[model samples]
Target: MDFVPLWAVVIDYILGVVMWTLIGRFGMGLFLPENTSFFFMRFFVQATDPLIRLFRPITPGFLDARFVPLFVAWFFYMARFYLMPWLLGYSVMGMLSFPLEGEIARGLANILYKFQN
Candidate 1:
């Protein structure tokens, strides 16, 4: 199998994680009240709030502010699922085409091994 370069592997991993966080934050909003004191929920809110705020002003007047998470999630979804892969010279086949967790782990292991040797 062809090895993915370390930079691509790292970037893909980070993008996937951030995109997943945005999705989770959006999903949590659907059921939990935003003011809930749960720890993970609070962390998710704190983490994604800036992105939501960035998109807030462009939000349509008819759409409620609570829905901003969904829009921010969509933005990260597009960046992770489409833009990153395209920039990396891969066809846009969604997450399946991105680097796997194991691949990133292996790449990091290889880099560390080389540095030590």
Candidate 2:
């Protein structure tokens, strides 16, 4: 296997962790009010704020500012499912798309597939 694809897979895992954290932060916000003093909430906000800011201008105005996390998550989803594979010269559908489960499973599967051949 090429190093480029392996590097892409590592990035995929990192994106998965960040994407899920963004989703969790958004979901938690629905129940708990924002308080910087709170640990998890603060961590979530600090962790995801930069990413949200990076995407905010491009995200549709119709989307409320509070939905920035979701918007960024969508961007990551697109990168993982579409952009990465395209860059690697593979069709989007040819690679495992869902990132919530982490990349270990996919990486292991790739190793096993290579061994099988």
Candidate 3:
């Protein structure tokens, strides 16, 4: 009775990655311009450009270019945090809704607890 659908996990993980990538891009953009030649900045731009373009139709013109990554990331976060759980018939975001971050947090906590003891 504790099983969650594999499809649900995959979708949650995919959305999680996109959300983090967008967040990372936003964080990097704060200190680096879009035209920077640095590999990491370039990689963020390359990875998230398609997503930004996909959401341009819904993105507000009033928002600044530097904020687009975060704006896009919010949608993914919303879908993962709310939609997935609802779709899975969960009243809250349980493990199924946040498998990626949830497991990572749990693993880190265990590691820290062991170290502390």
Candidate 4:
């Protein structure tokens, strides 16, 4: 269904927030040994760096650089909570009614309505 992709995006955003929160609360040291260049860390760094870079400039430096991840998480949550539903609603309205479209739209509308509370 059309809303499936939008739901996936919402899930990804939630995962991103959780990932950032954990990393921000506990620095990489807890997860990786010092001086260890594990493949997972490399992968995580690659996945998160662009987002950190985007937010770094706007973030206040009252705390350590660790806050970057939390800021990114908050940004993702805001986008998910405020922007995603509206975008999905517009997208659904634009599409032709396939057999599954009504069901998908109803599901998405329900999700958005629930989140609004």
Candidate 5:
């Protein structure tokens, strides 16, 4: 019997998307300057700008501006790793506690497996 609630799954999935997007912005920032006209970089910047702003108070002032996305992503990661299970009445974190990332990794692994065969 599954004990996890549907609402928890949905919230986790949404937070997962935000966390991944923040990390993506950090990765892409390595290759593109903030003011560059590249479409993907622009999209990432626009999408995560609000989140960055929201987390600004907690963000460390010593971090290079380029690293803020990664810092914000870490906050999300911690929330999912610790807070999610606590909210769901679990005493410990499960392997699949992060549903969206687990599903994505499984899908990618399956695709790689098929390609290898």
Candidate 6:
């Protein structure tokens, strides 16, 4: 149940990282070349386009092209690392019971609590 959503998020993040690495290192045309079949690029375009499109507006043109993928990757990582635990803790006894969620929450809590103490 919850694992599905968690895995989806993880997979999305991994895809984002891979796409970003490939494009940043090899250039966009490598994935979306004009001379080849359209089908090959479909998955690459779909997975990377949504995030790039969403961020393009707010980001300056100079920075937008280079930073969009990195920003999206960081955003996904933060969502998994910070928001998930906070939301789960806020909902359930200030403690997460699920193993994965619980581990993340405890690790983050320990880090924050250490700074406080």
Best by lDDT: 3
Q: Per-residue lDDT of 1-117 in model 1, one digit per residue for the tens?
A: 255567766777777777778778878888887789988789889998887777877777787656777766667667766776666676654633556555667899999999999
TM-score comparison, 5 vs 6, better candidate: 5
TM-score of each: 0.68, 0.72, 0.88, 0.49, 0.87, 0.42
| Residue 25 lDDT, candidate 2, scale 0-100 | 81
lDDT (Cα atoms) of all candidates against the true structure: 0.73, 0.75, 0.90, 0.58, 0.88, 0.54
> How much lDDT does candidate 5 score?
0.88
User: Which sections of candidate 4 miss by over 4 Å?
Assistant: 1-30, 33-35, 89-117
Q: How high a TM-score does candidate 5 get?
A: 0.87
lDDT of 2 by residue, 1-50 (tens): 34455677777888788888889788777767657577898888889888
lDDT preference between candidates 1 and 3, better one: 3
Better of 4 and 6 by TM-score: 4
lDDT of 4 by residue, 84-104 (tens): 555556544423222233456
lDDT of 6 at 64: 38
Model 4 error, position 109 (Å): 23
How far residue 67's Cα lies from its native spot in candidate 6, in Å, is 4.1
- What is the lDDT, from 0 to 100, of the residue 107 in candidate 2? 86
Candidate 2 residue-wise lDDT at 92: 45
- Candidate 3 clashes: the total is 0
User: Which runs in model 5 stand beyond 4 Å of their true positions?
Assistant: 94-96
Candidate 6: what lDDT?
Answer: 0.54
Q: lDDT order of candidates, best first?
A: 3, 5, 2, 1, 4, 6
Candidate 6 lDDT over residue span 1-117, tens digit each: 354356544654564465454354225544455344665455555566666677667656665344556665555555545565565455544232334444567899999999999
How high is the lDDT of residue 86 in model 2?
78
